[model samples]
Target: MDTVEVVCSKLVEDADKWRAAADGMSKAADAAGGLAMGAEQFGKIADERGVVSAYAPLQQTFTTLASGAATEFAKIADTLTLVAETYLREDQAGEHAMRRLEDRL
Candidate 1:
């Protein structure tokens, strides 16, 4: 039971870290999109026709992929938190029942 608690605690900690990482990923995606848009306005070469236009699809795709990855990370974090909470609840309940039986004995 002690071991289970320790494991659950670790799971919760990992979940928190994952949540933070997801936030960072989302922020990075936003920043990247902004940079790409800015570049499209200022970084065009005359000879390289259609180069700026080509970047539009790439930027959109990158942003979409990053957003999806962040969503998955958040989902995983939520799942881990739920699992840890459930385990802790069950452990406490079992301990409580055991104590009651011991008292009767």
Candidate 2:
């Protein structure tokens, strides 16, 4: 028989860090959105189409990337937290079972 040990606390700690990263990404997404708004306003006053054309695509791309990164980071954080919780629950259940078996002896 082999024994395996899992550091569930470590998993949860890592999940918290991932969640923090997600928060940062969300802030970036907000910043990108703000820039897009400013660019839209500036485009209205600009005489040339080149500046507007260049910034429009860039704004859209940045907003999309930031939003996507936030979503992915959040998913990673959630998964890590869930894995840690599940492991902890199962370990407790096993311990309880062992205690019950010992009580029967």
Candidate 3:
């Protein structure tokens, strides 16, 4: 796969990992009313990385498009990346918040 596709695939993979981590965190947080002592906070890194992985090139794509340097496929990729990034950032922020809570607990 091309670099852009490869990056997106990795981001998607990382997003899945983050989603799993978020799921586990939700369960733990629900059970403990937050995180228990010694519990590791997870997902934030993956989520954030996933966002960057997925969107960095997307922004690039748009920039290229606006500058008339992008082809149709690149525009499509950029659009997809923008949409994907939206979700990824939300998840990342949630995970980050969880991490902060864990740290405080």
Candidate 4:
């Protein structure tokens, strides 16, 4: 669980960095000359690219989070399953012991 939390935190940090990169890209584009399509097309592409780039980070974050969560959940599930099996075996043994005592009486 602690590891999961750390991974999640790291993913968030990466997301922030990705966002900053996209923003920087947008600003640089804005500072450059007008679009070749008489300004309108260029402006549109720039705006669209900025927005699209912004989502790129979000998409990456989602993918990372999802994959990590799945892996962690699998591990947790395996642990729980092992615990359950152990308890079940113990219970079965106890039941058998009790039955044997009853028969001896």
How do the residues 25-66 of candidate 3 rate in per-residue lDDT, one tens digit apiece?
Answer: 444435443322221232456545565455546555544443
Which model, 2 or 3, shows the larger lDDT?
2
Query: Candidate 4 regions off by >4 Å?
Result: 1-44, 47-49
Worst 10 residues of 1 by lDDT: 38-47
For TM-score, the strongest prediction is 1
- TM-score for each model: 0.81, 0.81, 0.31, 0.43
Query: Candidate 4 on 1-105: residue-level lDDT in tens?
Result: 554335445555555555555555444444332222332534666766675556546555555555555455445545545555566667679889999999999
lDDT of the candidates, in the order given = 0.85, 0.84, 0.53, 0.54
* Candidate with best lDDT: 1
| lDDT by residue (tens digit), candidate 1, 1-105 | 568789999999999998998998899789767866534474657326766667778888888888888899999999999999999999999999999999999
Alpha carbon deviation, residue 56, candidate 2 (Å): 0.7
Lowest summed lDDT window (length 10), candidate 3: 33-42
**What is the C-alpha lDDT profile of model 2 across 38-98, one tens digit per residue?**
4456666562646766787899899899999999999999999899888878988999999
- In model 4, residue pairs whose N, Cα or C atoms come closer than 3 Å (at least 3 residues apart or on different chains), thus clashing, are none
Which one wins by lDDT: 3 or 4?
Answer: 4
Task: Tell me model 4's lDDT, rounded to 2 decimals.
Answer: 0.54
Instruction: Tell me how far candidate 2 lies from the true structure as C-alpha RMSD in angstroms.
Output: 3.7
